[model samples]
Target: MSKPVLTIFYQFNPWDSSIGGIQTVIRSFIKYAPDEFVVRVVGTGAPGSALGVWKWTEYAGKAIQFMPVIAVGEDNVRKLIPTTIAYGASLMRHNFASDFMHFHRIEPTLASLNWAGDKTLFIHNDIRKQMDRNLGGKAILWQQFPKVYFALEKLLISQFEQVYSCNSESAQHYREAYPELAPRVAFLKNGFDPESFYPDKREEREIKRRELAQELGLPETVRFLLFAGRLHPQKDPVLGIQAIAALADPQVHLLIAGAGELEEQVRREIQALNLGDRVTLLGAVNSDRLAQLYRAASAFLLSSVYEGLPVTVLEALACGTPVVTTDCGETPKLLSPDSGVVCKERTAEAIADALRRVLANPDLYSSEACVRTVQPYSAPSIVQEVYRQMLHRWQYRKAIAISSPYPS
Candidate 1:
């Protein structure tokens, strides 16, 4: 029998040009998908592409078809509506021959809610919590609009046959919030590519450490506390700097590996706190470099105010690096005493204290233990299971459609 066709829709292409956890997850899904299904992806195109134009390309070594909708607006809060309209129009006009439809984020989900097929929704985070934290300081309209939109989404989400969240806790919260739609919501942990992110040998670690020191123009003796994520309000990059300053330990340098809207603010704060030497903004780094940093660092840090299952945390653990994160999303569940530290508070003092403890007794958190904790989140196994479940559900729906006198 032929494999079933599955079409995935998202705001951004799952290629080198794009950078986000959802894009990574989508790439993993396609890369490790089982032989039972054929996957094709639809995403928004680059700005140069004309509106309503469709572009075809190959990415990530997948022979599977990649489609891009030429939507003009960029991915952000202000342009979400315009982008949604353009994307939805493109989706409506395009002819998709897939047996199943998958959506990665809210924009795509909203655009395709009425499309014909058994649909799946992948929730990357607790949208409500993220909005509250991201827009907490913004105007009343900025805060209130998302609330109304999400309220409507509560009704629209029921349209999806299966809804999965990266965080189990977030899944449970969603179920509790919409008991009528609880059966559709479940948790699927985020995963990392083991080949790209794994524990380094003793000698390998030493080599990478020296290389990293040379690349950053830092001394070999410096202990790196790595923070890898977008420099946004949600990520709270400022807190990482504050925590490092609070430590007041010159030897403990913080290496931030991503860039975003708050990059200028983060740099200003670093200089203002006189942490120019202690804090280094490496800007946006590739996965290979990030994995090397993970293997070389004393510990990984995440100071996000809220999150789902952060892919960075998984990648860090996969590289056998101990994580020091705030109590957000499903991080507490992922962290154990022997593996990492979950800060009790989100303040600079709390993060500094946790970092101090982890750095002081580095042996307490063994690399093996850290690697073991994240073994269950390997991309191949997790992606295989997702394929199996999605196929089963799709087959069941096909059976029902064939049996029923009415059209599905």
Candidate 2:
């Protein structure tokens, strides 16, 4: 009789200011949710003040509630477990009225899976595997914790009523790791906001492009290649710089935006490659400026070896910019003959070839085709699918509850 209320549990990485794909999904669902449902977001705070809550209104239907828990110290395993458990209990008690609960990442709060009336966990990526893979060349301390984290994730996956992954790759990974729950996993594609990214006015685009180029000290004769995302090893930002180096075209410049732990390493690599003047490490450009960079660039490049579903590629296409990406995650699924190039390998030479081909013949891919390929990923369409499935499951559970007769 009454509309069900959906509560989302999301992780907040304070160091990251620009919203990521996972955060975008939470925001979209809240913004476009049907009138019948109520949506609330619960953000886990970064280490330090891990037990405070803040509320804010974001859009017409979505409300955000952020909780800060005491910060977990590095290598302090003794305190991590207790803090996670305490935070989970606090979150469960705070959102007691929610009819359904959705978690953005697999974390300690997932312990509440047993109490939430309806539960869904959206697997963005196999975090533990990533941590291990990316830490291969890093400090020994960083390598020790992924093993512990992976074990905890395996335990959490078993408790969910339903599991959703951003791409088929993630779904398969989960299925192989947890065969018992494979049948319950569903695929939910990531989407973009068309209103914010659709083709810009020609005059406006040109003017904005000029302004961006001037700000970045890019020359008018140079063709800009944009890579937008965290500057982390997992993203392979160094590979992007390597690709630009191989291009050896002084006329082409690579713009690396966003910051991360690998910043210093990437900078050293750029200099070693003799790309000091050619590669620009802009470091964490804001959303508005990022949109302008997308419009100005001759093409967008993604060097990630693994990803959930990169919303950046979709946003680039939505802005009518051709994209060049590796065959990582769902990138191949989103690309086509008209959109741009999709390479088979993550090597610098592979990416270099793709970039050369697109820049050589931009006429082959039209703005119309780029827009068409990314149309289904619009925020409204994707959110509608999420709501439909959630409501369907809720109804099925209600039916079962009514039919199951209590002991007489």
Candidate 3:
């Protein structure tokens, strides 16, 4: 039999310039997609770009078709429903059909409105919590019609075939909040390309560390605590800076990588706190460079106020760098005595205390042990599981569709 067609509404550009944890996960999926299905991705171009033929774009060395829809608004609250319909319209001419559909970082109802009900919505963050936090607090629920948007979110979750939560915390949240929809929920943690982020040899790691120190005009002896993610309120980059300032040890330096709306605020805080000498803002390095930064770090730190499984933490663990992160998402599931520390709370004091504790005993987090902790989450394994989960759920749909031959 021919492989089942698996059309995905992936929500972002698959181009090399794309950034963020979601983009990282999508790229990995495209790279090691199971042979059980043929794939097609439908997504959007950067905001304000013109809408045109974006289909037939090559990604991860695969010549898969990609439909890049351009929408007018930034919030995407008003545009999502129409945007998905338009993309589906574009694909219909090509006789694009699938056994099932996939939606990532989105509430699938709108996008999958014109398609099959056999959908898998991958929850990347707590959307409801983010919205409650609001724009000032940096939650993304700024809709022209708040009530309608929320209603749509609710409808999508209740109607989709499955919800693959990005972490156990997310899975548990969904279960407790929406008991009726709990049966379809499951954890699907983020992963890394082990080959790219693997641990370096002893001498190699040190040499790269010293080289990076020289590049940043810092001493080779200074140990780094790396923080990579958006400088948004949700990621809590400001909290990370505050924690850095609160640390008692002068050798515990922080390397910030990423650009976001709060760049100006982050700069002002660093200046006000007089952390100029200790905090280095590298500002969004590429994947290869990020891997090097992971090796150079004494430990990785994420002070996110909320998260769904952070890809940065996954990469750090895969790179064999111990983590000292806030108690959020999959930290408890992923961390170990051999891997690194988890702060008891989100307070700057607690973060500083955790940093000091890790700094004092660096040997407790060896390269091998850190790598060993994340072996199960390699890209190949994660992709295979995704296939298995989707395939298992799609079986029910096939049984009905073969007899009905109906449209979504």
lDDT of 3 by residue, 286-327 (tens): 788899999988889898876778888889988888898887
Top model number, TM-score: 1
Question: Which stretches of model 2 miss by more than 4 angstroms?
Answer: 13-19, 44-51, 54-56, 59-61, 64-66, 70-97, 126-151, 176-179, 201-204, 396-408
lDDT of 2 at 211: 78
Q: Candidates' TM-scores?
A: 0.90, 0.83, 0.85
Off by over 4 Å in 3: 46-54, 71-97, 127-136, 142-150, 176-180, 389-408
Clashing pairs in 2: 47-71, 48-71, 49-69, 50-68, 50-69, 50-70, 51-68, 51-69, 258-284
Query: Candidate 3, overall lDDT?
Result: 0.75
Clash count list over all predictions = 0, 9, 1
Please provide, for model 2 over 86-118, each residue's C-alpha lDDT reduced to its tens digit, 9 standing for 90 to 100. Answer: 556656555443678887756644557556477
A best-first ranking of the candidates according to their lDDT comes to: 1, 3, 2
Q: Is candidate 2 or candidate 3 better by TM-score?
A: 3
Please provide, for model 1 over 287-345, each residue's C-alpha lDDT reduced to its tens digit, 9 standing for 90 to 100.
88888889999899999887889999999999989999999888889888988999988
